[model samples]
Target: MMEATTQAEVTAYWNARAPAFDGVASHVAQGGVWRDVLAAAFGAGGPRDVVDLGSGTGACALIAASLGHRVRGYDGSEGMLAVARAAAEAAGLSVSFDAAVIDQAAIEPASADIVTLRNVLWTLEQPMVALAQAHAALRPGGMVLVSDGLWSVAPQFRSTYDPALAARLPWHGGLTEADARRMLAETGFGDARSWQHLFASPPYPGDVPMFVLSARKA
Candidate 1:
């Protein structure tokens, strides 16, 4: 139960964090493995049209592009997009980056072969709206790969969090695997399936399970 954040506030927050966020890759030891996981999740033999919403520093976009998929990344933070652009240019990868609010982010109707949202859903004010937009952007039978986890719901996590601080933070808490499946189904997606893994990142406790929720446009 955190206070609602305005679009401007969200944008500003991420913009200020752009520099540190750009350095995120250094923390991950298995970039190649993660990329392969993503590739397989989206299906192989790609040269597919992919749109990554809330793409941030373009982790998903850059990796997918490397695998020969056409990619377009959208983020609310211009700072993040700037970092993503520089990385793409340095890597000699062709990725189109745009700045747009999460709820307003869009792509051509039935044009995308896949849509990805990684480490992004929990920050959204209206996760369902983003899902609906993803559903609309994808072609019939297109797949969506959503990665998220229950960060704040863990007992160990709760022990460390100050009650007052937790109550005020903008985090949307966690969305469990079952909750993800239900959300996708309700958003006009079908064949919803999910699995969990032990994933860790900076400033967070280890052994927390991250969930990947996959489904296709019906």
Candidate 2:
């Protein structure tokens, strides 16, 4: 099938929408539960470096920074990085921005205490490859945090449909909750545990349905 993901198209899509993404993003999320979920995953603070994948606008990175962890948010979109960098500066936070896909570079193996894949796993044509890379990048005791959901099969993506936004995404994939845990466990993430919370935003079903996941590497 059309390579489920088109990186160039997805990058362009995020680039154009980067500036305004954060403003509208929160409303779409479930009261920002993922932040708290991440906090719980890695604990408050310690010696840890977190790799936030597809970290558009650097929301998660900034949170980790605030909690006193070295944070790096990587994205292929320079525009998105620009926006994230600006926000980090405004918040007086220190988060390094890396400009590349996870698989494109040689990440320091076993250097990270936590690997973050928020909302990114479902958008890749090579989720397993990316997961393996993330696994390799984590320290022995490190962890991988992933959060996305089952894609739209019912009525299949109707509302929340913004032409400007929709035009930006090249393609999308939906991951089952079971597989989220399976990938992490098989990739050598010791004691992989799945976290699922129904985020109902009082009304919009599509915008609120999401899950945040984390798996620890042995």
Please name the candidate that would achieve the greatest lDDT relative to the true structure.
1
Would you list the C-alpha lDDT of every candidate in the order shown? 0.75, 0.70
Where does the lowest 10-residue lDDT sum fall in candidate 1?
A: 195-204
| Candidate 2 lDDT over residue span 1-218, tens digit each | 11324666667777888777866665236436655556677775575788888788887888778778898888878998998899899989999998887677458888788888876766565677788888888888788888766556432442223444444443244556677777777777766665554332422345535566777777
- Candidate 1, pairs of clashing residues: none
Residue range 15-47, candidate 1, lDDT tens digits: 887877755433145566667677668776739
Give me the candidate number with maximum TM-score.
Answer: 1
Candidate 2's clash total is 0
Worst 10 residues of 2 by lDDT: 153-162
RMSD in Å for all candidates:
4.2, 4.4
Q: What is the alpha-carbon lDDT of model 2 when measured against the actual structure?
A: 0.70
